[model samples]
Target: MTLVRVSRGVRMHREAEPDLAAHVRPLTRISGSCAASHDTAARLWNFPEPERRPFDRRIHISRPSGGARMQRPGVVGHRSRLLPDEVAYVDGLCVTTRTRTWLDLAEALEIDDLVVIADYLLRIPRPEFEGRAEPYATREELLAMLRRHPGKRGLLKAREALALARLGADSPPETRLRLAMLSAGLPEPEVNKPIRNDDGDTLHAPDLSLPEYRIAIEYEGESHGNADQIVRDIEREERARAADWDEVRISKRHMANGARRAVEKIAVALRARGWRQEDAA
Candidate 1:
């Protein structure tokens, strides 16, 4: 079998025959109280990371001030004086709690990066999660985590991103679109707004919406262009228009120029539907 070296300490089979998770699995032992933290823990928790950031093969484990400095191959260690509430166990491995992970990431993430994570953690009506548990953590929980780390290095950026985080953003692109619109001075639009036909058939929702103006913003990924999804999307848009709602569809290309084109199209659609441009001005 052909092999590729992902890093000095990590190697992978060129073929997709084995479980990928096995490749990055760490051999770690904490002396007293230690847990996996940061990106390593993120992988364990199934958090969606930014596309541009790579997965580091080095395992990150954190200690809460009483553990011995245990060392192993491919392990990176961190020490923080964490409170009792900040640790959790999953799949038999001790790990930082979800909110604690968010706080830890503040030292490394940008405002946009933090917002994307926050949006994911607080998504409303998470159909993908089983048993109806809270998706990640609540907004207030995140705020309290920030409060516990008042003087942290990235506090300002984290605070800015925290203010922008909202529920109902189902994907990274949708969250980025919301930030773009707000940065461009447009009124904050509601995320994943549902609609129903006069006959009570539910269109379910669009990526973003302005209810007062009857505007819907949709970000279509590559899958949306698939023949089956295309047919369904066309039907949805046609039906939405027939119901007097304007649909603004965005794709990867529209995300260029800082989403200027997408924002412009939405602005024009809003104006046609009775929004005053001066209100944004």
Candidate 2:
């Protein structure tokens, strides 16, 4: 008969020798702040995967005096205080709240990147907002701050951030398609702007519209595959034509190439409409 001594509190393989010290080494390497969350009871007992990023590898733990005495190599420590509810114990490690996680990420990432992360975090299933005990008064408060900032850079950043923080499923393909246009250095078009007939009846709202150019771009997604959607799209196109607007329809396949071709097509259409690229630029 073969006998094996399985280590308690850590998984052991019968076929392999267990290195208890090696297993504990990783735990020791974690910064005290991240260890709070990553190594908390919820993660250890429940065995939940930690949502750690490359940036989190350098977490710095602060002392009660709101200062960091020592930091691990490659880790940066900030002297800050966390509220009680904002803290969670996991696997004997301290984890920051989701709100704090987002705030930190927002400060670190570019507006576009921050928007992507914010969108991802907001879409998380049943997210808990921790604004009551944090620097920001509320999520809306933060959004308002972004909106209040001057210039297109601030407005666009705020818009993207707010869009990311919106509660719902992933954004529609049209929204993503429009964002690609902005990222491609094209002038931002009004989103879902309406085109009305002379009779003032609402005709159609194109996915993106540049009134100055009298041009509209429509994103045809998988939903347009349905017979009803196709009919509606055609009707919309005809109405746009009647309204003297040059309309271009782009499918998901076309948008996958990152809007270079779409921008060219738009430029051509604008040229035909008596507008110059330099003028638009």
TM-score against native, each model: 0.80, 0.51
Question: How many Å off is the CA of 45 in candidate 2?
Answer: 23
Candidate 1 C-alpha lDDT tens digits along 31-132:
446677877777777777755464455678777666654365667777776788887765456678888887777777777778888998998655556557
Best by TM-score: 1
Best by lDDT: 1
In terms of lDDT, the poorest run of 10 residues in model 1 is 23-32
lDDT of 2: 0.52
Off by over 4 Å in 2: 1-102, 107-111, 116-140, 143-176, 183-185
Q: For each candidate, what is the lDDT?
A: 0.77, 0.52
After superposition, candidate 1 runs with Cα above 4 Å error? 1-27, 51-57, 65-74, 125-133, 196-203, 274-277
